[model samples]
Target: MTTTINANSHKSLIRNKVWSRLRAVALPDSRFHHDYSSFIADFEGSSAATDLLQSLPAYQNAHLIFIAPDNCLQELRYRSLTDGKKVIVTTYGIRRGFWILDPEQIHESQWQMASVLDGMENIGRHMTLADISELPTDIALMVTGTGAINLKGLRFGKGHGYFDLEWAMLYSIGKANQRTQTIAVVHECQVLDEELRGEVWDTGCDFVVTNDKVINVKDASKPSCGILWDKLEDGMLEDIEPLKELEAIKKRSRAG
Candidate 1:
């Protein structure tokens, strides 16, 4: 007899299993930090990365954006080429999951000696905690992810909830759209076939890129709004000061 599992339950099981395995492997030597750099080099060396990077639909007119490292590893490679276009790099702080930085800041930094360090720093400048209302509508965003987590539903980050919060805020203000593509970079090991559990506010990336392939996730049945304000618990809003100050959220609430 075959048993059917509900989407949420299946996701929870997968997350628990995946997290346990990942934590075990990821905690050993922090080798992921350097290993990912080699992964990037291999990716760049292959036709897959070259073809995908060159064929991105958003490459023609993106002005502002966010990009992240594949998995939790800091590969330190600049996948997004500005080509003189305005670009922003999303990064993580010592205490936060991700933040935005300007490209120019990385270009002028001392860390530029190593190609990987230079790439990471350059992408750091576009990092910002600003609300979707504060960003340009024409902006394009690329978020990295390890395929290990089930993305069809809500998947937990290492610890911080910044990725969900940031994506949720953008969706709340109607800033996330076709023009705004959320891309995930990952290795083959990280990819999963199961749908994860999702809350009302859960958001999924629009694309998944890897050394071997690129998967378009726009058709996936996940959260569309990105942000589900009503589902947020009490005191949650107080945790992130920047979210409170977002002009769009405040403006809409005042008008209501």
Candidate 2:
């Protein structure tokens, strides 16, 4: 019998290893979420990771947060709402662009329901680039999940650039900036021992929280950039409505 490696790529191999580790755990019966096998999200100890994330001083202080729509982040979103923090989140794959989910608007009883993926669409108020630009508040934290990350603050996602684009659009509108704290939550198994090369728009995280502990990147080099309109390729403009809308907004701004 022969075993097959997924590919020659480093990130692919790391992702498969993490996936295998995640799958070995028997999911507790308490959490309600989509199957991890179906989506490139977290499993098993996601709640514990979220608990660690919520304990950080930055998380406690943040008034406005941007959370990725990963099942692993579902609990964090709920806690954010309960903590009275404003959550800026994109729908799955960012298909519907950005939305603002304010706890003040939602009844306290519904926070848990409203934080889930489907609930966010129903409860959150959709915002366009112009709408977001008009916001008086700036983002305090930008939290997400990734395929793999190393101590060098390098990160790789499941290949789609949704999280990168989310940051870019927000940065373009001045809703987010370099000073905003970024966090990547994952199971400990997902942490990489090898340093991955950084891209210009990588926007690596400042902190990596897992089920057991928090690892702060002491000398993280997070390079931030606004939307690279020229780099928009492979039908990205057509697929992501927010990017298309943002491109038009910037064009009109430049024209005026």
Top-TM-score structure, candidate number? 2
Could you tell me every candidate's TM-score relative to the true structure? 0.60, 0.88
Q: Give the TM-score of candidate 1.
A: 0.60
Stretches of model 1 off by over 4 angstroms after superposition = 1-9, 19-55, 59-61, 68-100, 104-137, 147-161, 195-198, 221-226, 233-235, 246-252
Clashes of each: 17, 0
lDDT of 2 by residue, 1-256 (tens): 1121222266666666666666665343234333343354656788899989999998999999999987678889999998899998888777778888899998888788889877877878998878888988898899998766787666767766677888888887788887888899887777878755555767778999988889999766555577777766588888887988987877898999
Candidate 1 lDDT over 156-237, as tens digits, reads 3432345566665555556555456666554444557764445545556666665577767645333455545565546655
List pairs with backbone clashes in candidate 2.
none
The per-model lDDT (C-alpha) reads 0.46, 0.78
Best by lDDT: 2
**Which runs of model 2 end up more than 4 angstroms from their true locations?**
1-8, 26-38
